[model samples]
Target: MTTKANFPAAAGSVVVPYGHVVGNEKWRGSEIAQRLQGKIKLIFEDGLGLVDFHLSNRICILYISEADLVAGDDFKRRLVRFRNANSLGGIVIVERTQISDQYFIAVQKLVVLELGMVLLPVANQGEASQLITQLVREQSKDHNSNPFLRKQCSQLLEASVFRTVQQIPGVGKTKALLLLQQFGSIHRLCNASVKELELVVGQTVAQQIHTFLCS
Candidate 1:
């Protein structure tokens, strides 16, 4: 829904702290650098670094391979600070591989779901770059249109309501919130017929919800 002009021009306008590319070059260098060369700012630092991918001004992504979870406490701390910050754009953790049950559980409870950040498992570096670019462009759009950022910024009560409605297939945060605003509750929203929902939302979304409920 956003225009290309709204997207980051080159290497996103952010700067990665120095040393972010030094020791971890194997996982963090070359391909990642090329993808982000003109897409984000890769800063040089004399001190220790925190995040591996700085996609935008508000959101920074941390990388975790299957083997690197245990030694990432510093990043955990930065994530906490970012979570508590007033800035709306939240953290996104990009896990490079399929991790163990314990690692997944630890990340889910300690950071991802609890701290209000997104954790995505990407198969390769190329996918990671493309995904980050997509997210960055989406974040640049209006708040009403950027569902991910909207959900991230929402309060508990509203978030719960949105999540409930979003469970319907093809129902994103915007449409879910709109449906709730129109119908008042999930019971009422679900009870509405396709025609009734179409009157409020659109043909596509109404059909999607109807199909989902009926299926």
Candidate 2:
């Protein structure tokens, strides 16, 4: 069993190699660990402090069982302690069976809003195993592969900006394009004088643009 003293408490210091998960030794025979078999590589380590699983060097998961909710307050303290002790991103996996449904809202507020950690509820260990597998896969994927992380096309960005400029009252596509060509960007256009804007658009449209931006 690996003791707490064997490793640093700072989760960022722990290096989780690709395509693997480090689980707490206590979970070695647990349903979650068992179900995770053949899905991804799982390695057990002792005294991982308050974390139940390490998905990566920067992210660790804390499992809260139905019994933990029933028992009350103890799990809250553990979460707070983990937050205080480590700089890693903590994902709270909660078992939300019918018996534990009542505590969901309160747990959500504390784990997500108060503690600023992610809280994901699962029906059981099997569900948790599946979720963990997906999370691991997502973490392993290249940043560019995620649509949200990918660089947007320049043409799409220019069209979007053109549309935004057109949304101003009294401004149409011709004036919007003229304004963009003069100013180069929304920020410069917003900061432009009514007189400067009149160079591209008329006095009325320039005042309208100024009012829309400033007011």
Candidate 3:
């Protein structure tokens, strides 16, 4: 069995290579280097700013904060599309120093963590890459240690109820498992009332699940 310590670590310190771009000559070399000082610069070019960061051997990091300038809704939609399409390993939002909103603050924090870049709080592309590499290493450790967890994960994959529970408003896979584990069967779970389900899976999810199952 693969152990946690056997997980591969990210590259330590390597001199980044120079990149080629067609239209942007002035933005090359030291100018781009200055913008990417602390990061392990994988690729940087001026025209359209095609920057790719080394998140891990299997994953790469990409940022779309610049995309936000196009259209807030469109940017968010495109960001999701890009992430889904490109298999973007993580996401980070860099604020423009001028705007400050509590709503965005919360969102920023949530996105950073969800993308596995908790260490890169401010969301610099370089830092986000490094954080993602670290997260991959940590997740590798978690993946190795818990065989029972893996078995449960595989069982969930085969069971449509796992996916169905996630689609319901407030119920996630975790709560779904808790419900199944406690009830010992989905039939029992379906029979559980809103109040009884609430005791196992939180009131909000329980109520939603009750409506879903009863309906």
Candidate 4:
């Protein structure tokens, strides 16, 4: 069976796992590996070899395991080695069994070293495949959206309202926006009496704003 690693790199590189293979569970492994291979270029090997291969490829590693996972000093050492050897994009460790806190901590440290994140309790190969596909789709959408443009617009809109509200001592951004929306203009909002403001900004805030403006 082809592994997820066999699938083409989604961006520059990605690492997928063959998962766990208990005795006589070769079929499961083969099946997952085949499905992955059909999608990308894959490398199939034991856990130790998988680690080594990730270092060599300089790609993100997706580790699939069902056995008890313990990330001890040895694993940390390997992570350090991998980091030094390759431009480690990310590390996603998928566990078949319930993970222990100790194991999670150890893996988390490895991720920190590699600048990666851990994905927990993946359940099975199918689930892992689905997760990867969804991630790719989301990433693609973000790429298409021109993050800088979106961020700039959001920042400008926030700053405009924030600065405007700050001029009115007791009116915060929310109250200010509520007043503006309800009255259709800041000038109209200022013209409103406390009783009129209360309908939109609530009684407590309206009182505060009236006191500030009257002062």
* C-alpha lDDT of all candidate models, in order: 0.53, 0.75, 0.42, 0.46
Tens-place lDDT digits, model 2, residues 29-143: 7889888888888887766778888887777789999999999799999999988878776778899999998887677656643465666779999999998988787656763
Score every model by TM-score: 0.44, 0.63, 0.36, 0.37
Q: Compared with the true structure, what per-residue lDDT tens digits does model 1 show for residues 1-215?
A: 11112223122344333222221233334575567556644433222234454443444566655555656565567667656653434444445454443455455434433464555656666777676666555655644444654444344235444654565667788887788889875557656899999987789989987776555
Per-residue alpha-carbon lDDT of candidate 3 for residues 167-208, written as tens digits (9 for 90 to 100) = 556767887678768887556776788889889878887888
Ranking by lDDT: 2, 1, 4, 3
Off by over 4 Å in 4: 1-31, 34-59, 68-74, 99-102, 113-121, 136-215
Name the top lDDT candidate: 2
Off by over 4 Å in 3: 1-35, 38-42, 45-57, 64-71, 93-100, 105-120, 123-197, 201-215
Most accurate candidate by TM-score: 2
lDDT of 4 by residue, 157-208 (tens): 3444334444465666777677767876444555679999889777888887
Candidate 1: the clashing residue pairs are 10-38, 10-39, 11-38, 11-39, 11-40, 12-39, 12-40, 16-43, 18-44, 18-45
Candidates by TM-score, descending order: 2, 1, 4, 3
Candidate 1, residue 66: how far the Cα is off, in Å:
3.0
Report the Cα RMSD per candidate: 12.1, 12.3, 12.2, 15.8
Better of 1 and 2 by TM-score: 2
